[model samples]
Target: MAKEFTSLGLRLHADAPHISYVFIKHHKPKEGEAEVPNALYVAGLPLGLDEVSLEAVFSVFGHVANVVLHPSKRSAAVVYESKEDVSQALQHASSGQVVDFPLPAPEGPVGLKAWVASHRAQRPGNAELQKQLDGWMEAHEAAEAAREAARQAAMAEDGWTVVVRSKGRKRAREVGGMSTVSGGIAPAAAAAARAAADAKQAKQAENFYRFQQRDRRRSELMDLRHKFEEGRKRLAALKAARHFRPN
Candidate 1:
């Protein structure tokens, strides 16, 4: 830790009251991340403020990748395109201040009681979250490999190369927005539904053609019956008169 200094009008944690300033260690790049100094964590944002507008103002300093707001923690994290971008942003800030972020949607230059942290401190439990994600990805890849191997074995003894997934195509989705294998309907159920739909359409087409053919035959029989009725009426009239003429 450097000289015990206090940040003026900045708070790292929301739970701690009465302590307006915090003594944070010098920023070291987060472990396991890329060598590029690409992220900046901002603290002391107001509740309910959106990340989009926060990013919009910070964009003036550098090309921003994403801005994630932690409403529960009352902090936000901004990722830049490159390490140089981070340095440029720090230069834009006032002397001794890490982040010069203005309060989101302020009338004048009057800003919030905010401070920026390293990528690590900006988010709590990020390490554990990353570990879980990595484990999930590994399991997903292993399962896919097993399926491919089984498919190859099923292919009759004729030598055939197993085709792998195409590049750039995503394999599995995470649990947030889309309903994945955990929360979504099973694959077997989906396949059965598709088969049922196909069968119903086929049945409908068969009935439609059958009805059309029946209608044609019925019309032919109706025309013959109508002609017979007319001939019978003519014969009756001729017999009643006791004479028959071409008229």
Candidate 2:
């Protein structure tokens, strides 16, 4: 710290109870220049005061180069283009009364009255909202149509003919000398189905052969029984007619 200071006013509130002043005193002449040139430390700035307003306030004395405000501390450091403006500001600060600076009207409407008027003006009418909704729906339908066209183009590249059905879901079949549908039965599944059918036919043939053999054996047994029964009857008749001799 080179021990250099400058005077500036503290405008904390309009009727602040006490007033404080900071005076710049130089004890000894230093060989080099000051650490910060043409700068004044300002305190007691009102909250919500922007840099533009601060600059405008200080620019009356000189061209304000920059203003760094600390809202929490309610203080700001103002840098002037030349040292003469610093001297002028310091002279103004030496007066006991606060500087009378004109605060510009706020950029936009503020407070409850202005806010209510702005809100009412900005509110959208029912007709406007409905028109916006209609525009959005139209855009959405156009986008869907574009996407469908692109999808059909891509499918046509792969030799597929898509059939769109109104009642059910859309299906695509292979065309241009292609045998199968795009998403139909796979080759492995087809092979498995053929194998199952062949196995079923083989089982039916085997069962038929087994049934023929069983039927033939049953018919032979029935014929032998019939012949045996007829021979017994004939022997009985012969015994009755005395044409049988015992040996």
Candidate 3:
């Protein structure tokens, strides 16, 4: 059977963190009904987690209905069949421990559908919006560059020294140590390393900034395309209704 969203009593608030109240109704087997109960609602969790681990942890209490992970938000939704199962799951669902990440605690009942809708509605679509996104991306890139420079400078100041392991040996085995360079690092090597570090940082920043820009553009284009399609469908429906009107 298809999953029902209405079964979860989800209350959506504009200014607060999303939350939802889930209530599962128990019913006896009529005739050849499945022994396990069906899950009514699921809560979304933060991203970067292994599905197998979550399943293993939650399954200890009751059967898991669905666990949907969102890539962008880095969150997931886990649905349980019975209220008793939910209670059990809640006991083990400690933030940043069981899942190896901090889970956002919802204030009250929340609807995932509504939250998605709100994000869609608030998304930028126009040329001005694109310009703003580009500006933000550029600013982020610049800030990242400054941070990289600072990190490299700090590393250079706190030089890496080579320490000999033994006193008598044909070739001494040098171990890495963080000690001040008496004569300072070779100017050429230090400059080259700094340049290399800067180049690497710039490349990484550019790649990340470009990726974000591409995703934003793609989302905007898709939203516009969907809206256009909906308008066309509405127009076609109106035309068909008018043509088929009884005289």
Candidate 4:
């Protein structure tokens, strides 16, 4: 295993009189320790970030292996199946890349922060970096399991949760809270949805009836014209067949 990052930097500053801000960075990699090439560490994310949105952004390059978002820590870790995918995603959004991609938000014109995952700090010639990296992998797995459990618990007994995906971001914004009685959704939103559906059906039915009426009227008109034409032809035939009679 070759060291992925050669340097590590962590600093805390008092951004405000009573608030402290922490900044983290990775600089160098050690010898023989393979870099954590498949994972990405994201920071300064917007509130209510989710795995699907992250995938929609990064999976364009390749398959996303996994995503672990630390809500408490206000950061997230994204893993990819291939190094190329990681590079592609990073190139699209990394602040340190040659062509940096700033992941802009929809509501505001602000870019999301993103970078490649780095192992824990170690001495210049120590082999302990691998141990730390292995620990990180274990922790990530545990966090992911916990997140999935929480999501399941939040849903109704039917294991179904309905969400409307916004055009801006694919985040599932719940229109209304769950329905306690039916264990589905709120009554008001459901009613609105039902009403909208009914209106659409009514409109379609009206159009269909109008079409049917038009076709029936046209058919009747054609039949009347045909009858008149046939009667005229019969009268002409009778006149021609009869002897020339004086009235």
Candidate 5:
């Protein structure tokens, strides 16, 4: 459950001389909202007469919600819906005259708002409360500082290094067996080395296959040209023979 700070105050009527503080039994009935259909029972009345006696006393106002009783334990609680009903019940139930049984005092003051204001005046304000809070905060901070100091002292006593490890690339290279004087590999130089190797390999493999393809195509063209020239010579000879013959 979440914790909360609610202020509860007690007020006494200045004129009521007989009572100092009303003794609400350490075990008293809890007052619930009026709509709930349950009432508490007063304990230790004679078994058969108990319910009849309570109903007779409480039903005078409105309705008796419920009643609880334990004769051996000698305690009881009665519940009613209306404040008017409860007021009427209390009128008859208190002292030995009605039920001849003891009952607890009413829970809250007769004038609740005035009682609350009186309590607020008597209590501390936010500034004084804050001062107390600040004192606690300072004490907590001092305790934390002491703990940190003790931790550091323990580390020193055990020969631990307090300095943080450096995250710089140059420092990492020096730690990893590389020289720091030259400031590591230059970007341009690394790019040039990779490019030169790629260019040399590309040039060697490219033209060797292209030269073989070109030579094969040239030989096939020459053979086709020779065959076409021979065909032209045979046609010319045929035309000459036909002209020379009787025509």
Candidate 6:
């Protein structure tokens, strides 16, 4: 087989590895497997063609449903309302057909000057903005003052000593050997006081109801025993006083 292939000038060298050829038949379309209707792939479109202009040109033949333009490829895919509209467009529309149509009006600012004017019209003046910022700062400061006053009143009511920190970044000297006291009690001391109060309250409540129940039970048992003893003595006296006894 290698020599026969070499004689035919097919194989470059004799005694080469056997080569296998596998043939695949062309794919045939099944029944009713036609391309979709009412859509057409249109080529040779003008470079400047936009979706709106393309639609306008195609709409003259029939009602165009949609027009998608590919500017780089200079082509468009147009879908019409019906297959008949696509057929009509293909029959009539050729090069230079439907050349004159009304162009759409410009939707936005056309030039750099118009854009700059629009932008300036939308922005607020510097003086107006500064005044607004000053008003906002004044309001914010007033709100802070009111909050601080309310906080001080609340701290005083709660028996917390208010210790004001030194102003202007000076290190304030500690009073009464306290390491740090900014607004009220130091966080560590406050936490210890709260924990001690909570423990005392829990100790007072622990087993309180159970003690009452035990005391009430003891009192009831004592009363029952005293009643039984008194009844026994009275019955003994009645038995001793009996005049006649049945055998």
CA lDDT of 38 in candidate 2? 78
Ranking by lDDT: 2, 6, 1, 4, 3, 5
lDDT of 2 at 238: 83
User: Which lDDT tens digits does candidate 4 get at residues 1-247?
Assistant: 1233211111112231232122222212358876766776666544334676666654665898897777664666667787777666544433432211233343522223222111222252345677888899999999998896676556745666644323332333442354322134566777899999999998778647777879878999999999999999999999987967777
Alpha-carbon shift of residue 138 in model 3 (angstroms): 32
TM-score of 1: 0.28
How do the residues 111-201 of candidate 5 rate in per-residue lDDT, one tens digit apiece?
4564686798787799988999999999999999899768766766676544433333233223123222223456677689889999999
RMSDs, each prediction?
23.1, 19.8, 32.4, 27.6, 21.0, 22.0
**Candidate 5 residue spans exceeding 4 A from truth:** 1-110, 113-123, 161-247
Candidate 6 TM-score, true structure as reference: 0.31
Q: In TM-score terms, which candidate is top? A: 2
Query: lDDT score, residue 123, model 5?
Result: 76
Pairs that clash in candidate 1: none
- Please report how far candidate 3 places residue 69 from its true position, in Å: 1.4
Model 3, position 237, has a per-residue lDDT of 96
Off by over 4 Å in 6: 1-58, 66-78, 83-94, 98-143, 166-247
Residue-wise lDDT of candidate 6 within 1-247, one digit each (tens)? 2221100011111443432121111112358876557876665443344788768766776888888676574566777788887666554433223324444544655446665868888776898889999999999999998998787777766766666764243244544433334444566776899999999998877647988768878999999999999999999998887965777
* Cα-based lDDT at residue 4, candidate 4: 36
TM-score for all models, in order of appearance: 0.28, 0.37, 0.21, 0.26, 0.25, 0.31
Candidate 3, residues 108-192: lDDT per residue as tens digits? 3345655776676798568869899899999999999889667655775677343323323224332233342223456677789
lDDT of 5: 0.51
RMSD of 4: 27.6
Worst 10 residues of 6 by lDDT: 4-13
Model 6 clash pairs are none
lDDT of candidate 3?
0.54
